[model samples]
Target: MEQRIQSYDALFELMPEMGAQKELLGCECAQPEYCFTHYLEPGYKEEDILVEICQSVTEKKQDSGQITFKVFLKVSKAACIFYKGSYNTLHKSYAMLLQYIEENGYEICGSIRESYIEGVWNKESEQEWLTEIQIPVGTGSLTQCIC
Candidate 1:
């Protein structure tokens, strides 16, 4: 697949609000509607993790209430895989993607992004859910994985 950098303006919320679906809906945005939860920290633990909950905005919008506007950019080369199944089973798909990256001599260079393509709003079952896992890759010779 062809690699391209993507950029979007998003609304950010912290911790508890980050996972609040209702809160995200409050912000208005345009087409190809979707939401993104960016893990700002390494660990996925709930206690003190920093996450940026974002939705694509056509034009730069002002932050209101708890929502703060921020830019989300995916730079460099990227490898993506379409995952079909429950979110609980995402780890398996992620492992497969990471393995493919390593075997192909590409190193992960940034935070992993899970884009929700189809979910509860449309699909009736978790098994029918679709998510796109996008991992940014580096072109350098460094073998270290930064993801």
Candidate 2:
């Protein structure tokens, strides 16, 4: 998560350098979130989980060193789980979402998205932090925000 935060910071700093602008999705400020997928191998450790942080841009930009970009396609349906608390307990929300999906016959088809709605940047207390976990699933309700 810290690494993803660093990537978000780097992306904000490098956007202008790459001649690209952030495409906000109906938000007041730059979208503050770490949208990524973990690449797990049999020999990988918890600390070794590797992910590629992604950010939205107004348009595709030419690659300049580390400014490479890719379009993030949308998911047909997602199990949206909302949690308000500390990062340490964030796993509980994921566990809940997984259990819900399994019991509801929802298949995990794509990468999961972690959106930091409220965090240390805006909130003072860790207990006030808000996170939304979107797990791509097959046809069903468009979105389910089990807060």
Candidate 3:
């Protein structure tokens, strides 16, 4: 597994659906206490700290109470560990990614972004689900992580 750095602008598009009220919608690397509101505005690049959002969705029928939701995250530049196993094996993949980060001299600047690339409602096939574990890094920032 390898991590790649990428700049994203459309991340804000998902905020409303996720029910984020007062939180700064950018990366979690910023100090959680101080909410940076304008950092994500157009052309404000200096404050672009590494950010990630863990996203998940659920659906249910009106009669039955069996609701299902898939959870994942999206992050800036970090390594990725793809797994092909049951959902119970997620922890092992996480530990492996952490080890890789430590070995490569990178720190987790903030919280994790879990992106649910595939889910039940989105697809008829339930055999596959895609997730991304994004970890912040020291390089490649529009601005920088101050907290």
Show where candidate 2 strays beyond 4 Å.
1-45, 139-147
Every candidate's lDDT = 0.63, 0.56, 0.41
Predicted candidate 3 versus true structure: per-residue lDDT over 1-147, tens digit per residue: 011114333434433333332122222222222111112132213244444332322322132121112232334465666554344455677788888888887765555444445433355554575545545554434344322
Best candidate, TM-score = 1
Model 3 weakest 10-residue run by lDDT: 35-44
Clashing pairs in 1: none
Which is superior by TM-score, 2 or 3?
2
Candidate 3: segments with Cα more than 4 A from true spot: 1-76, 123-126, 139-147
Q: Per-residue alpha-carbon lDDT of model 1 for 51-102, expressed as tens digits? A: 4556675665456555666776546578889999987678798889888998
Q: Estimate each model's TM-score.
A: 0.70, 0.64, 0.41
- Candidate 3 residue 147 C-alpha distance from true site, Å: 9.3
Return the lDDT, model 1, position 35.
68
Top-scoring candidate (lDDT): 1
* Candidate 1 Cα outliers beyond 4 Å, as residue runs: 1-27, 43-48, 141-147
Order candidates by TM-score, high to low.
Answer: 1, 2, 3
